[model samples]
Target: MRVFISGYYGFGNLGDEMLLDALRALLIEYGFRRDELVVLSASPKETEREHALSSFKRGNLLRLFAEIKRGDLLISGPGGLFQDSTGPWSPAFYASHAFLALLKGAKVLIYGQSLGPIKRRVNLLLVRFLLSKASLVVLRDESMSDMVPRNKLLFTPDPAFILSVGEVSGLRDGIGIVFRRWKWDLESLLRVLVKMGFPLTLISFQAEREREDGIRLSKMYGLPFLTPSNWAEALRVLSTFKLVIGMRLHSLIMSAMTFTPFIGISYDPKVRSLCELLKMPFLESPRETFAFSGYIRDIMIKWDRKSEGLKCEVEILREKVRSVFTRSLNLLLGREA
Candidate 1:
């Protein structure tokens, strides 16, 4: 059987690349051969070389359509690809592949995705219609459960939780902060970090777009800047931080996966959702005049308790994420789930 995987791949975004890695790993472990897997990517050559799989350029409609086969499986995401907040184009672009697969009689799986802040009714309608046709829809959370049929909706953890990391031991020091382009007050946040008196590092999750902001922040604040090339390197770096103040959702996910304590700075509902799911501390808006110092102080005081609790929660989530993949793949292949 042939499986065509699609997502925001080969774009130099660590989080999306990690999602592809975790999903591909799960598929292979579940009995699919490497040769049977194909990926649709922006950089086909890099995707093929890095993942060791066949690939097609995501923007080449002719090639993408030519490769679809009836009875083949199309796995459409594990990211927030259906949102219109960035623009209407993103939802339309990702949906086109799934729609094409459906038209070609291939089974479509909307795998572990987050639904919208889709402000436009037309975009919402289009997404609803696409979900209606999918053979299976597994969401990363229940926030958008209303959009999917109850019988077809199953909630699971983000696939990044399935990534492998080495065992961490001993006391960890320093603080890691991940930043993206958002409307948050950086100076105020930095004041709190300085008061906390830990060595701070600004980590870039998407270097292509975030490197400029990271460099400016590093220079202004006299902090170190790190741009990890891949997910494994990012995880390794995050594991060394005693505490991570993150703006990226996957940064917190990686921190939890490494059993490192984290505080989320929520610029989106998805970040808040992850914090709620894992029961962690988050600042809804650091831009507001909230008592930022006290918040960090409180977390530091309860550090041991939070770390132990997060480790337990991560283990439970790992099992749930694995089970979701196993059952979904079984059902798709017509075996008893």
Candidate 2:
């Protein structure tokens, strides 16, 4: 059966790309051939080249409708695509895709997504209607459990948890910082971290805005910058770090995957939710009054214990997440879940 995968792909965002990567990998492991997989991407050429799968431009509605009309299923995300915080367009856009798939008699799997902080009544109603019609709706966290029917809702960790990384030769005894363009007081945080005397590296998770931000931060702080070309490379690089202070959700996710302790700087609810779910320390946004030094000091004092605990938690989470995907895929394909 042909499966059409859709998400925020081809936008140079490593997190979304990692979601696609993990989803594709899991689907393959679950017995789907590469030829049966199709992706809807903003840069279809790049997506096709990178993923070795069939693809078509995301904006081509005629093509999308035609594909769903003939395809067996449509996977609508493993990302936060249903929220209106970014604007109503995002919810409308993703919901419309699922709506089309259902309209054309194709099954819809709302894969590993984080549901809304969708404020607008119209957007929320439309999203709920589309979700109600989906064949399966998997949420990444329990925060929005109320949004989906209990029978339809399955909780799994982010799909990126299933990503595999290779080993790196040289491991570093330093902290890595993953930053993006946010209003947080980064310079002050850097000052506090520098006083702790460990080496610091600026790691970039995205190819565009985040890379530029990393470069600027590296120069400003006289630190080295590293930008991994893909999610595996990012995981390998993160594995070498003793700790990570990250603003990006996937950065912290990779840190956990690598068994590296991380401090999450919550700029969004998704980040905060992940941190809370993992029982990790996270500083809230607009953290001007947050006790940076005290927080770091406490984490450092408990570093070994925390790291060990995180390793155990991640392993358990990995198994549960893998099983969730396997079961969901099995059910979707008419097998026992």
lDDT scores in order: 0.86, 0.83
lDDT by residue for model 1 (27-111), tens: 9989999999989999989898878889988987777688888999999998998988877788889999998888889999999
- Please list the residue runs of candidate 1 whose C-alpha ends up more than 4 Å from where it truly belongs after superposition: 169-171
Candidate 2 local lDDT, 147-206, one digit each (tens): 788788888888888776556325557888988777787887888788778899988877
**Candidate 2, poorest ten consecutive residues by summed lDDT:** 285-294
Error of 1 at 151 (Å): 1.6
Query: For this target, which candidate reaches the highest lDDT against the unseen true structure?
Result: 1
Over 4 Å off in model 2, which ranges?
A: 168-170, 288-290
The candidate that wins on TM-score is 1
